[model samples]
Target: MSAFVDTLRAEWTKFRTIRGWVIGTVAIVGVIVAFGLMPGMQGSCGKNGPGSECSLPVGPGGEEVTDTFTFLHQALTGDGEVIARVAGMTGIATGEDPDKPNHTVEPWAKAGLIIRAATDQGSSYAAVMVTGGHGVRMQYDYTHDVAGSPDGVTAAVPRWLRLTRAGDTVTAAESVDGDRWTTVGTARLRGLPPTVEVGLFATSPQHSEELHTGLMSGAMGGPTQVTGTFDHLAARDGWTGAAWHPDVIGHADGPANGAPGAEGPPAPASGVEQVGDAMRLTGSGDIAPAVSGSGGLGVSITQTLVGTFVGLILAVVVGTVFVTAEYRRGLVRTTFAASPGRLRVLAAKATVVGGVMFVTGLAAAAATVVFGQRVLRGNGVYVHSAPAGTEVRVVVGTAVLLAVAAILGLGLGALLRRGVTAVTTAVLVIVLPYLLAMTVLTGDAARWLLRVSPAAAFALQQASPEYPQVANLYTPADGYFPLAPWAGFAVLTAWAAVALAAAAVTQRRRDA
Candidate 1:
């Protein structure tokens, strides 16, 4: 054990003594910070400049979310219930020419009955709604969504929705005939007050469709407005406040309740109108988690770490050279002579290189994430704030990712015995797939590449989650991954472990 420790110490000494390797490692941090803080990544947010700002509403769970909708509400006190029949839903989508638009309802457009803590955006709420395509659903707080009947509503076949509140629990139910109801789901909005807003709401998120031009791909979308017809609206038990009041929550023209940093320009006028026995509500925007794409405010913390790829290249090169340089200089024979166990020598080299890269990556990633967000905001960009835990994982996961890549590079260096060849192979297998997955490939081709390739490990940097309930583009370009963070890290760890094992066997069977 002491000899192995001595071997480890010697390897560390040799690594630091090599000025080129040390410089390369330092360059990793420099490149990561430089690319992360690069200028011209600005946004229209806070156009007034540095101190100006734009921000999204933070939900009950502290996640940035979209809470815009046209609400026709009445305040309810204590335990109560609100019921409404969604008679119909319709909407229009933007076309190439502003003069001509398509009359169509986006699949996720919602018209529902909600029991909210208040009219304020991002307040705790539970709702039962009929969607344009997803049928009936019970959604709450931005992230929680539960599906009901797989059926759309129409004037002739309306869907009846109900929300009953008792203490902190809100139960949602749906019915086909309004006579018999089936429980859809329930949500516990802890600490909900006695006085809450019970209302009918209508909202439509941005309408987007994949745009494929040959090998390249993108999304083309624009704001859309949806109108829902509701009849037989009734409130039972503990109802208060004046008659139904119409207000646009999270209006783009101004912040909710005079809060600063409104999201965008005024959307199409959203309001409620009495049409005979039914109320028609027209609204634009969404009541869902904010994600990165055509629908989101701007980018996520993952955007600040875009330089990880470049830093990874530098780290890989340094790791490869750490081992291959010794072989090229005929120092491996001396290393093996001193530490007769070839495996221990390889282990020592791996530990030294991995540890150095880990520390370097940790510093670079932490600086990039911490200061890069400031740079983004300084340039008038709205960066979604990640939860503290997610931020820590992304920062630490980034370090681990770089460390594993470096170790993998070391193994390749030992096997190939050529720095250029090993570095090229490492980049090809790790980085090229990521670039291709993000740009050239599309659909399953892109997802499969990310799923199987070493690039899958980059999932570690994905700070924003992909919620099944939110209808947004969940693509690699948007910083979403097919694999979970730790799962993706495990893939790279497995690859490195296999490579080191192969190098060990090759080292023992052949001359040093």
Candidate 2:
């Protein structure tokens, strides 16, 4: 351990003595900051900007959302549950949803049940329902959702839905026969009143063309309106079995009381009707990511980290040259002579490079999250940040990304023993693949590229993800990574480990 300490000190001294390398590190951080903050700085989102025309609703933590659906609900005043067997669920899209102009049904259209604070926009809520092609899901508020079943809407197979409330906690469940039940998920609404609105609902978001337009342009959003038919309505304790009433949320033109919608008068439940023991509910709207990638909220530094590759690429160059330059200068012989352990020398170099890059990355990410939102807001952009813990993860995850990249660079440098060749290799394998995936590749192709490329680690910085409950094309082009955030980071880490292992073996076996 003491010998390793001395080796680390020696490596650190070597790295810091070079003014050009130190300057390069600074420049790398500068590149990340400048590029990260530059893209969304001018997006319109104040009173008349891109997202200002229709002020999307906000959820529990002020998360930006679009909630404009027709609802059919009844009042429930205490702890109990509601169960309904849905005979079938289907929908149609009008010219557009809630406030937008549209006609037709989106593929991801939905119909289900929800328990909400009231018939007001931005209220806390939870629901269990069936979607167009995505299967069963439990969605809450405007931000959280989870899948329950892989089987989606089918005429042949009817589905059962249930929501149970105990104090502030709400649990959603689903069943096929109404005898055997499976838990879908659960959520808690803080300070939820004993009395709440509970009932059936349906909605559809912008389909292919309109969604594409909204996502690509980020300035206009007139989603496809949806109508769904439901049946087999039933309820358990706590519900008075009173007649259900239709309420609107997210009207586009006025203030909402229990009246309906966000900005306008009550939504037209043109498709809702009751037949025998079943009721059909049709509604339009969405509760998911906004077109601007901010979810109509402010832009987060995490999502903006896409541009950090510029800094990371420069770090790769610096790291590669750190060791390859020594080889080019014919200094490896002296290094091995002094240490005798080639592995220790490599470890020392890796430690120095990795440590410095980690600090640089951590600091850069910190500054971006801390102040990037302010810059966006100054320019009329509204960003919704994650909880404190997620913020910490973004900052630390960014540092880990840079540190691993630096180690990978050092390994390549030692293996190739040529500064230009090592740098080129690192950039080609890491930076170039990421750029292609983000820009030129199609959805399926982009996913494959990101899965294998070291750039997959970028998922660690994702603040926005596509929800299956919401209608939108969930692809890499839409800012959703194919792999989970940690999974993507692990893929890159695996690549770095393999490269380092090969470098160690070659350094030990070959002459300096």
Candidate 3:
């Protein structure tokens, strides 16, 4: 053990004494911080002159959320229930021809029954709704979603939705006919007040389609409006309000509930109209988690770490040279003479390289995430907020990712015995795949590359989660990954471990 420590100390001394390696490591931090604070990265969020601040509503779980819709509601006191039959739903989307809009409904358009703590956006709420193409679903607090049925609604086959609140628990039920009901899902909204707003709501998120033209790709979308016809309205127990009130929550014309300037064109006027027992509601915008990409704010914290790829290249080159330089200079003889166990010498080199890169990456990533957010916000960009735990994982995982990559490069250096070849191979396998996945590929092709390649470790910097319930682009460019953060890290670590093992065997069997 003492000899191994001595070997590690010697390797550390050699690494520090090399002026080029020290400068290269320092370059990593410099590039990360420089790229993160780039002056060209500007936003129009709070640039609405003055008194217009950019912000997003925080949901019950403290996640940034979009809470915009049209509601026809009445006040409910104590335990109560609200029931409505969604007779029909329809919408329109933007088309290539400005004069001729496409008559269609977005897949995520929602019409439903909701019990909310207040009329204010981001307040606690539970809803059971029928989507345009998703059938029936129960969602709450802008995040949780539960599927109820796979059946669309029509005038002849209207879907009956019910929301019953008892204490803090809200139960959602759906029915084909008014008489037969199936319990869909239940949500517990802790701290729910005695009196809340019970309503029928209609909303549609921005409609977007991915546009691919050779290597260049973009999203084209526009504001969409959805109208829902509700009939068979009924209420039971502790209904207080005498008449239903109409409200366009998070109005598109104003800076409320959504990021400033995020609302493209003003949606068609949203309101509610009643004729006898039936009510028609028209609304636009989403009641879901805020994601990056089309219809979302600006970006996520991941944007600040764009320099990581460049930093990784430098780290790989340094790691490769650390081992291959010794072989090129015939210094391996001296290393093996001092520590006869070839595997021990290799281990010490890996530890020194990995530890140095880990510390460098940790400092760079931490500084970028912490101060870069302030820089982005100062530039009027609305970066989505992440949980403290998620932020912590991103910081630590980035360090681990860089450390493992350096170790992998070290192994490749030992195996190849040439710095230039090892660096090229490492970059091709690790960095090239990521660039192609982000710029050249799309959909499953891009996703598969990130899933299988060493570049998958980049998922560690993803601070935002992919929500199946939210209608947004879940692509690598948007910071969403096919694999979880730790799972992706594991893939890169496995590659490094295998490379190290192969190098060990080769070292024992062949000449130094």
Best by lDDT: 3
Question: For every model shown, what is its TM-score relative to the native structure?
Answer: 0.93, 0.78, 0.95
Task: For candidate 3, write residues 1-512 as lDDT tens digits.
Answer: 99999999999999999999999999998998888877656777777777567777888888888889999888879887888899988786533332444447788999999999999989999999999889999999998999999999877889999998899999999998878999999999999999899989999887767777887777777767788999988888767667888998987565322455555555666789886778999888889988876546568898888888899988988888999999999999999999999999999999999999999999998999999998988887778888888888888888888889999999999999987898898888788999999889988999899999999999898888888887777677777788999899989998899888989999999998
Compare candidates 1 and 3 on lDDT and give the better one. Answer: 3
In model 3, the worst 10-residue window by lDDT is 94-103
Model 2 local distance difference test score: 0.73
The lowest-lDDT stretch of 10 consecutive residues in candidate 1 is: 255-264
Residues 1-512 of candidate 2 have per-residue lDDT tens digits of 98899888989998999988899999877877876667555534454635353245566776666676778888888888987766665554333335443333455566788888877777888888887777788888767778889786555888888999999999999999888999999999897888899888877664443122322422233344455556767667766647788765664433221111122233334346777767766665665544333112334455556557788888898889999989999988888888888899999999999999999999888887777776766565555556677788888888888888888888999999998899999999888888787666655777899898998987777666556555444555445678788998999889888888999999988989
TM-score of 1: 0.93
Best-fitting candidate, measured by TM-score?
Answer: 3
Q: Order the candidate numbers by TM-score, best to worst.
A: 3, 1, 2
Using lDDT as the measure, what is the rank order of every candidate, best first?
3, 1, 2
Model 2 stretches astray by more than 4 angstroms: 39-41, 47-66, 76-104, 126-128, 135-192, 208-222, 230-245, 253-282, 287-299, 474-479
Write candidate 1's Cα lDDT for 1-512 as tens digits: 99999999999999999999999999999988898888857665677657555767888988778888999998888787888899998786533232444456778989999988988888999999999889999999989999999999877899999999889999999998889999999999998998998899998887666677876777866677788999999998766666888998887554321223434334566789999999999988888888875444578889988888888888888888899998889998998888898899999999999999899989998989999999988877778888889999999998998999999999989988877888898888778898898878887888898888888899999988888777677888878899999888888888898889999989989987
Residue pairs with backbone atoms closer than 3 Å in model 1 (clashes):
none
In candidate 3 the C-alpha lDDT for residue 500 amounts to 89
